[model samples]
Target: MTVGLVVVSHSAQLAAGVVELASQMAHDVALVAAGGMDDGSVGTSLDRIMAALDEADSGDGVVVLADLGSAVMTAEAAIEFLDRPAAACLADAPLVEGSVAAAVEAQGGADQAAVLHAAETAWSPAGSASPPGPSGPKAGGGAPAPLTSVFTLVNPLGLHARPAAALASELGALDVEIDVNGVDAQSVMMLMTLGAGQGAELHVSASGPEAQQALDVVRRAVESGFGES
Candidate 1:
């Protein structure tokens, strides 16, 4: 089984909506929503969060994303109360974007830590504050030159959420640094920030031992129109 996700928010409708949107791309992932109080008021509920966490955890572990203020606190309390506290953790990320990224990564079969990284980095442009330089040691112990390529998006919707999530989630698992149109290819939010539409060129660059493989993956996704018309 893959990692699971829990979304905690003040509004029940908001939490359910986020789950609905994320489920589009990660249908197999357990995305539970814990929003509002038992009375359906606009507030956080520890009991609700705890119950949702239990529902989400499927032995692979669970990642929790919460909205501002008490929602976070409630989620933390729920996690702390878990029978296996270490089996779950909270992601310090935007409620919606982080949940989507986390869900995608989890659906891609990423471990809990990697899934957490995907969520926490959802709002960032690159993996780290500074751009990742070339990776992989060369034959002479030198850093390999970054590989670059360009692929035109042929999908009717181009680099939309589903495609972006697929690319970012898959690419994030590789031991390489990739940039698409100047945005980190491993960040779903960053890729969506490109606003690349149909027929737009995706300027891609990568480094590390898996650089070529990463480029090939992008090529396949774009050239195939991401399996769409």
Candidate 2:
């Protein structure tokens, strides 16, 4: 089973809304909302959080995202109460963005560590280490250029949330380092920040063993308008 996600918020509606937003990009991922009190008050509840942790987890681990400090404490406590505490962990990240990023990564089959990284890194910064130089020399004793592609977004929404998640999730699984118009291609938040709209041009480049395959994935998503238009 894929990694699951739990959104802990003081308001029930807030948690549910975040789950709704994340689910759009991660249809297959288990997303649970643990918010408010069972009595319907606007407050954090350990029991609620514990129940959500159990429900969200399948076999793979679960990652928790909280809205506020106390919610985080509650989440931590809930995780500790689990049968196998290591099966769940809390993420220090923004509630909405982290949930979405984590959900998409999990949906893409990323392991717990990678999925947690995705959430923790969400909206924190837009940077990636430069890939190490080419592994080996070419027949002519020179390294090849990175695979590149250019696509005009035909989708009505351009690089919106769902499409950005699609790109980040699908591309993040590859061994390649990719850049789309100079932004980290594996970051959903960074891609959305591009403000690219319909008809905008995307210059994509990739390096590493899966460079060509990574380019193909982006090409298909962009050319097909992310299956939107």
lDDT of each: 0.88, 0.87
How would you encode candidate 1's per-residue C-alpha lDDT over 1-229 as one tens digit per residue?
A: 8999999999999999999999988989999999888997899998899889889988999999999999988888888898889899999999888998888889989899988988888887564633434332343576767899989988889999989988888897888888998888987889989999998999998987799999999999999999999
The number of residue pairs in model 2 that clash at the backbone is: 0
Error of 1 at 145 (Å): 1.5
| Model 1 worst lDDT run, 10 consecutive residues | 130-139
- Ten-residue region with minimum lDDT total, candidate 2: 130-139
Instruction: In angstroms, give how far residue 172 of model 1 lies from its true place.
Output: 2.9
Query: What is the per-residue lDDT of model 2 for residues 1-229, given as tens digits with 9 covering 90 to 100?
Result: 8999999999999999999999999999999999999999999999999888989999899999999978988888898888899999999888988898898889999889888988888876455422233333442465567788898999889999988987888888888878899888998878988999999999998877899999899889988989985
Reference-based TM-score, model 2: 0.90
